[model samples]
Target: MAAGAIPATKLAYFDNMWAVQATATLLSHLETEDGRRALILDSTIFHPQGGGQPADTGFISGAASGFKFVVEDARLKDGLVYHYGSFENPQDDCVSIAKEGEEVSLYINPQRRDLNSRLHSAGHLLDICIRKMGLSHLEPGKGYHFSDGPFVEYKGIIPPDLLQIKSKELEKEANALILAGGKVSAPVLSYNEAAECCGGVLPSYIPTDSAPRIVKLGEHPGCPCGGTHVADIADIRNLTADAPHTNGMP
Candidate 1:
């Protein structure tokens, strides 16, 4: 962790909250009680990397902290980052950590953050579409996609003809779901409920007994997700994809 960074404690994975305007204020120091770090910003669009998603890029600024501050890296540990940066002085009042209720203005690189958010949400939609095509045997391998576009490799063998049909059908279904204006909700479920929705067994990687957060895309698509998504499917537009093939398999 660097210096002058404010750790956001109110957010968790899959949150899509972002502030349009930047506001500077004061905040309490969690790392040290005697110390009070200037609350430089109120809201941020920076998306920290987690669940295979990458971190968001941005910058912060104010007189309390300094003339300017850059967010070099953003990450999540149990869900928080030090918002690392530098200040004019080690003990200066501007850099001195403050308690909550402190005001600050947060400036985020919106274009980059928006791109990442779209790509991540698109990935989840792809996953749901793939499963609905009766290709439950397939699992996502490497999912690499940025603001420009995204590509996902599947694990199972797919028949060439079926692949084309499935891809087209998936596009149609996904688009229809989006157009229907369905509400997307994330709800915590018990282990039993999670298993039942996942077809009798939870993925080995997911912890057992712990309540799982499930994403419901209308009445049809539902699955576990820990990434930010739009409030409605309609937010997604111009969605198109290359033909699915068996070429990526080993």
Candidate 2:
């Protein structure tokens, strides 16, 4: 009802990542430096930029008055998700007027969402592919799953002599799993159950007594993730490789 008032933004994307459109109530709105603006929604289907995934770009329209808000990015500060955009009323002259407690429709750009999800899912699948190439001890370190040029880093570097061969092998294996079309699952579980779903492994930051969200891609290993992912591996038909590169061996 007011700017800076934290509202629990129900991220429907977590409930069903496949949803691209949703109706939301405008809980609040704020104007930043130089008139930049943002709207806070009670519940949104948009995934805010975080966890290496780019923010969702979309538009919101007033359900009744038909005013348009061109949303360029979604962000999170504290526990609230902000839909950042330009607000306009083409037919009216209300300066900086988006009413509080108004009904709005959110439309997430499907192409961007699909591409980002594919690339991100591929990054995880790449880890499995690498391990399949007989590098079992290599732990996942960092990842760059942006659509531009996605790559996942491991704790140790692979031999230069094997880079070309291994990358190609990894690509082949990853694509095979993609083609196999296994179900991608996101489930919440207690730490022990989460660990069991993920091959009895829990990341150091995950509290043992807390429930963790897990993503399982087919029969391959599952991991804790908050990023949006495709519902099926088949959605990612082509997960290519550009050779495995890494930081200096540790």
Candidate 3:
């Protein structure tokens, strides 16, 4: 509401990851340093690129106004979701067409979104497989869920001799669980409640007073996450753990 300040965009996808279309109000539009115009909305179904996932691409059309903005990329900065793209028809007064408080319709590319969600959920499924296979010692680390080479890294190393054996075992276990699929749920809870859902404690990086969102796969204990995921493990279809890559970590 301030001159150049925009409020945090409510994440509509957080409540419904399967939603591809949504209605939102135009909050602000500004040009980035790179010259790309960014559209901010009161709330967004667009999942900004983060949490090991790529951004969602889509188009926004103003209601009763022939203004069209193609969303090439979306990013979050300080809680604001910036829809980065340009107007369909460029003009000197392009900004004038996108008025503040005007209603707009948002539609995401469903095929791309589904693929991203499947890949992301598979990464978490791997974490579950690791725990089930008695490899609980390997601490979960960063994950790259991009379609090109999606992988979940761990903090510990797998010995060279056992790497091949473990890879096969992991792949078998992952697919087995996928066949025995279960529902997945993500909910926002208080720090204490979230810890209980996440087995016992949350990561230290999470603030004590903050209400963290926890994603739970079926009856398994939950994990703190802030990304869209499939409604069920079965939706992941299948999983194949290619090989284990280890660094020189102790």
Candidate 4:
């Protein structure tokens, strides 16, 4: 099958599964009678921008036909992800489709993946940092930016004193842990262990039987996460906050 094509099932990236294989099953193939064009593939790792995250960019290739295509965009339709790409005309009489069970390789842009990974980890760090400051009432606002520079908005106003203190405290703590060479650990924990380590009950959204992955920053911070993170805290270069208010909880 052609590489980077949409698949019958969505592959989750929570465990760096994309690093191993980017191949998918050959579902259905389409083309002109003269073998001028074609579209085929089963599964893919090209994230299609959902849950406030951006779509992933990557390339696809077919070894037998020497077919290579650039995945321009990916989107979800009826719970299926479709990868859109282009290729040159063929010379064969019929547009032969790949066998239904064949596999193809998909190469994701490393730079784009790195950016998305960093942004996702940074968002989680920000959440934990806020909670550490004892601002229990504060919650993250909508419109979170995880690409390029990263930052989050609070739901309501923040007290000037609390904001100033938290701003400096979180910055200092995150940077210090980074400098300390803290490792990002993802140990699977039982329900009891997870609850004890995370103060009390797990979030309602977290599955009960699933082994929870925890991201820890030395002895200071630890939280449940399902996103990729730098091996060490030192990888995080900088962190800052702005626009603190004193109205409502965020």
Candidate 2 has what TM-score? 0.91
Off by over 4 Å in 1: 1-45, 82-103, 188-201, 248-250
For model 3, the stretches where C-alpha displacement exceeds 4 angstroms are 1-4, 248-250
Q: Could you tell me the TM-score of candidate 1?
A: 0.68
Worst 10 residues of 1 by lDDT: 32-41
- lDDT head-to-head 1 vs 4, winner: 4
For all predicted structures, in order, the TM-scores are: 0.68, 0.91, 0.95, 0.69
User: Candidate 2 vs. truth: CA RMSD?
Assistant: 2.4
At residue 200, give the lDDT of candidate 3.
Answer: 92
| Model 2 ranges with Cα > 4 A deviation | 33-35, 89-96, 246-250
Model 4 spans with C-alpha error above 4 angstroms: 1-12, 17-24, 28-43, 75-79, 88-100, 141-145, 160-165, 185-197, 207-226, 245-250
Ranking by lDDT: 3, 2, 4, 1
Ranking of all candidate structures by their TM-score, best first: 3, 2, 4, 1
Residue-wise C-alpha lDDT for candidate 3, range 1-250, written one tens digit per residue:
4425777889999899899999999988888888888999999999999999999998999976668999999999888999999898866786887788899999999988999999988989998889988999999999999999999988876788898899999999988888888999889999999999989989999999999999899898889888889999999999877768667422
lDDT score at residue 80, model 1, on the 0-100 scale: 44
Q: How many pairs of residues in model 2 come into backbone collision?
A: 0
